[model samples]
Target: MNRTISALKEWLNPDWARHRSVPPFEAGLRPNRRLDEGTALLPEAEFEPDDVVIRDNGEVVFSSGDGIFTLADGVVTRVATLGGQVGTLLVAEDRMIAAVDGVGLVTIDADGAATDLCTDAELAACVTDLTLLPDGIVLATIGSRAVPDWSAALVADDRSGRIVRVDGSRAEVVAEGLGWPGGIENSGAGEVLVSLGFDHRVERRAVTALAKAGTAVGTNLPVYPGRIATCTDGWWVAAPYARNRFTELLLDEPELLREMTATIRQDQWFVPRLRCPDPYTDTLQLGQLRVHGVIKPWAPARSYGLAFRIDQRGRIAEGVHSRADSDRHGVTGVASRDGRIVVAARGFRNLIEPQKDKER
Candidate 1:
């Protein structure tokens, strides 16, 4: 009922500024083959990964499936098994905190012993990312409270997401009613920047008073931004999925969206994903239109890979891309290691080093 009214309002007088406007790939956010032309770190793994973090000891650790793995001294090994899907990862001194899908937030110490940090019910589902502040306050993002899955929350326009503060073995939701807080990062001034996924912006939130509305730091994003990590100069942000005109139109029609959600397979929905659906079985769009035996890289694609750097003032500084014709799509996680941007290309099922120049 409520969705129908919202849909009516959108259909009757569509406000381009309110929802459908996407920033063009120009200026600092320009598209490039940096992502597609990069090299995968662990091609042997061949499994989708979530978030990544570089430890104080220079080990690159990442979450995938039910385990946390690390790359140290040119070798990859499983560090811990949390018995559930792991998403976000945070490095704190000799310990690492991870968001386990069904088990809640767990911390693994240097000895590889795992312990539950926060068992908050709100984090049982979509725990996206985590960050630690200068004052030692740890914050995590719950992508949605109303629905467990991202696609369902996106289609329903659910704004039940939150920013959770971790204190010892307990956690509290400091901010609520957010349109999918996809990532959280400390701004080095005692404040934090949050990536609101469905909202398509990065917001600056006060850690001392999070229940209040935050100030938008970055807006007019062309994609649904996710996990944010500190880079050499500023910050590295990952945009896991690009906006599609066809999908945006579906959002404007509640009945059609509901019908498609109820009838079609989720992977085949008109929504964006980490990877594209099988071409032979999915609905065809002109974006995939090939001319002269090649699909242009700038063509509107269902799945897109993007990891960009943003300045301190929240302006995009530079970006890497895997466009329509590239198989290296869905850059969901990002981190900086040895002057190179490390990307967790979930669609490609491996970590990629997408930076020029060499330090080794």
Candidate 2:
């Protein structure tokens, strides 16, 4: 009965009822209708993939909540288990580096031996993503120190995120007071681009300018951006989950959010999730109702998949999407190899190749 009343109140609220508008696609761009048509590289893996990287030897390695795994020729092999949540994966020459929840940055060799590259003092918080530079330097993004969970960090909205530079186990803060930093990648122009998750944009900063302010590169993205990877022509940015209109409305409702955080489970909270286990029977947000046995793909997407290609100038070149009605949601990581773009769709627990040539 309480759930029904809450749903009724959400339905009646004017701010919550209003749908979040997405800007129309630019010229030469269209929505992706067949995002699930690609092949699943790891069909048997049960863990949620967070990031993927292609090694120099043509091997594909991905990090999941369980650990790091490698896929080659339809075979999946376990590399190493971190005993904690793994956030991102990076392959540097012969070493595989990963960002772990409680373990900080770790390196896994070819023999699956795990070694600590950076400890809690270097990270001082949860590490989300890392990038390998040409000169053997590492750039990482720190999400928050108060909470180890990403969802909890978002709910707290403390703005304690930052970017750090790690060299030979030594780490230094390059930028501070960010809004849930997610992805990190070199911009090829003496600067690194980072995804500000809660800010809904990407920013670029130089490594030497530790205390200098950064400039926004990609602004007003529709979804929360995750990992950003360099491609042949430019960079690929992943939007893991769609923005929730109801949640946006409640951002200023501090008392309500505090109560909900105290009472509701992390997975059950009305936030953007990677997967929807029981969308039909679960508590509905304002615009996510099933009407007459029909669920619209564009109506209040809970876990939508989206990726964008941006040119060197940071303009969005192309995009692909999997709507709320599709199973290929939560695209967190993207990589390009030999002219093929591969994405880690965490919601579906598979690797997908977004059809870039398909037109509207």
Candidate 3:
């Protein structure tokens, strides 16, 4: 049969064979090697948080789907409602700036007054993340203006994402033609680092040379990088979804991927997802057929959660991981406070904090 011959040819190909040997899911595979052994989930809040930042007053500010909330003493208080899916939050002096999915960048005051910050037509797309610079400017990452569905954009290989700088009412594109720029941060010395999700790498560029091409920093990451945050020693990078062999193998089989995307429902497809509540509905993604009364947590996963710490030079120093069996998946953002690492576990819908050590 033609199908039999095609399988034989694929197995004979050296590259395909090597990649095929790498199992799509391993029984006890933890990429970070249990670096998150002591990490504990924090108290639940009213809504799921996407991003978190430490205010000048030491209060923690986070952006949920519908509003911006502040967390203190394990209590969450809604400070402002953006009326849209909030992506990222930044506290500049006394002002609270946020990037709303359906809306553009806006600044919110203490009394919940919202004012438009960047209204440039080009920057009105899905603003994913933002960071405050030392010079009082704000840098934001736009995923794509053409495709609202980020999942579709990734599979379609949409390269329309961009990075922009916002100063007062003026906005300028710093970099363009990016493949889903998910996170932005100041990388010190007037340079900025951005995480390109679909590209599976991080890039750095100077603020002055906005038109210049970026220098790749973290290359060929095993996971799709989401957000990057600065810490005392270096940077905390969030890897929302782990690498899967099926997705990796499809990188060269564009036609197959296109057919799958066209034929399958978006939610049922074998793409990385942020949340999966019903295990039965996700069996297809697990690359398995469900037998009666036989569901396992360690089932194969197309997505997992991971975070890593990188040095000032952008080299990975340490990491944390949640394997396929774990519930703590989809780590979209990370922050550090008083030596405690806080993670926005988007999949689990809870913030996670590692148990404090008395020695530190």
Candidate 4:
């Protein structure tokens, strides 16, 4: 690990970002998709996939502004990306909820109504990820990730991160001091498990008083455990990388993790930024240079979409399972239940348009 970090440092040069190429969508100011006539599909139908997920029965749910597609065994069966850029999707009880970043949270009933449960303004109160808790409360992560200086970078946002609990129309702050909470889960026994992205740690909180329950057995396990899932085992975590590698952390070794967390405090040597900024904008100093460094000298570029085990324990270490090159663009976010895995690719290009008018 030390050698890798040293190598990265030695190869890091001021000209690194110059050779990097920023994606076309990210280089422009347009949202990935625009609602010209209230129709979901665009005229060109070029909006790419942002996220994906799996249904309870084994259907793969993938998102793109063009439509939401349901895949079975890597084959597309149904597509539904209309009226929103699907940022995240999760199975909540009998229905599914799809979060449309700056738009609003939509609850798709078994019949698929796509009812708006919470709008952009309501969610702006700080809800990033949402999950239905047992007792009628909707558990959500309400945190802000720092604006990255580079593109396609997997580092955590350190500015502001938090957790929230929303019951019907009421909301409450549950936890804070986290590095951009990305994924959330609730234990059957009133414990909420959260993934701290920047910190690369998992933590639990009690529901009653919203007090700190405990840090996950493992700490500093990986750079970005994208999502958290609960299964028959213990707790499952997914870590995505630029090499398109996905790793699932099995918490079955509770004793080993507990001991490791208690003693390990020194920060691990992490790779520096490796993405190029917009080429048209020379204002972003050394942005392109960094990209050149990562591709030319640092190493071949790779990205991990998502990885995790069906069971939370060591019973089965599900290898990194996801589409290759899925991380090339907007792909991120994953959730699993039973024997299924759901991947979500958020369209970060056009989060929300300034000209978009709120429904009156």
Clashes of each: 0, 0, 0, 35
Best by lDDT: 1
Lowest lDDT 10-residue stretch of candidate 4: 24-33
lDDT of 4 by residue, 1-360 (tens): 654554576589644322222221111111211212121222132444444555667665655653565655434544454465565566777777776655556677766566767663545433446667877678777546343222212232244566666665455666665666667777667777676665556666677755464646445442355556665556445444332111112122335445544565412112221122232332222222245333222222233233444234323244332222112222245545563433342322211111122321
What 10-residue stretch in candidate 1 is worst by lDDT?
Answer: 277-286
Candidate 4 yields a Cα-based lDDT of 0.46
* Collision pairs in model 3: none
After superposing candidate 1 on the true structure, give the runs of residues whose Cα lies further than 4 Å from its correct spot.
Answer: 1-19, 357-360
The C-alpha stretches of model 2 lying farther than 4 A from their native spots are 1-30, 122-125, 281-283
Q: Write the per-residue lDDT of candidate 2 for residues 95-205, one digit (tens) a residue.
A: 888887656788899899999988856474577788878789999888765565667777787688877889978888877887878888988668888888888888787
For candidate 3, the 10 contiguous residues with the lowest summed lDDT are 20-29
3 versus 4: better lDDT goes to? 3
Instruction: For each candidate, give its TM-score against the true structure.
Output: 0.92, 0.87, 0.83, 0.57
What are the per-residue Cα lDDT tens digits for candidate 1 across 242-297? 98777888887878998999999887788888887464454556376667877678
User: CA lDDT, every prediction?
Assistant: 0.82, 0.77, 0.73, 0.46
Ranking by lDDT: 1, 2, 3, 4
Model 2 weakest lDDT span, ten residues long: 20-29
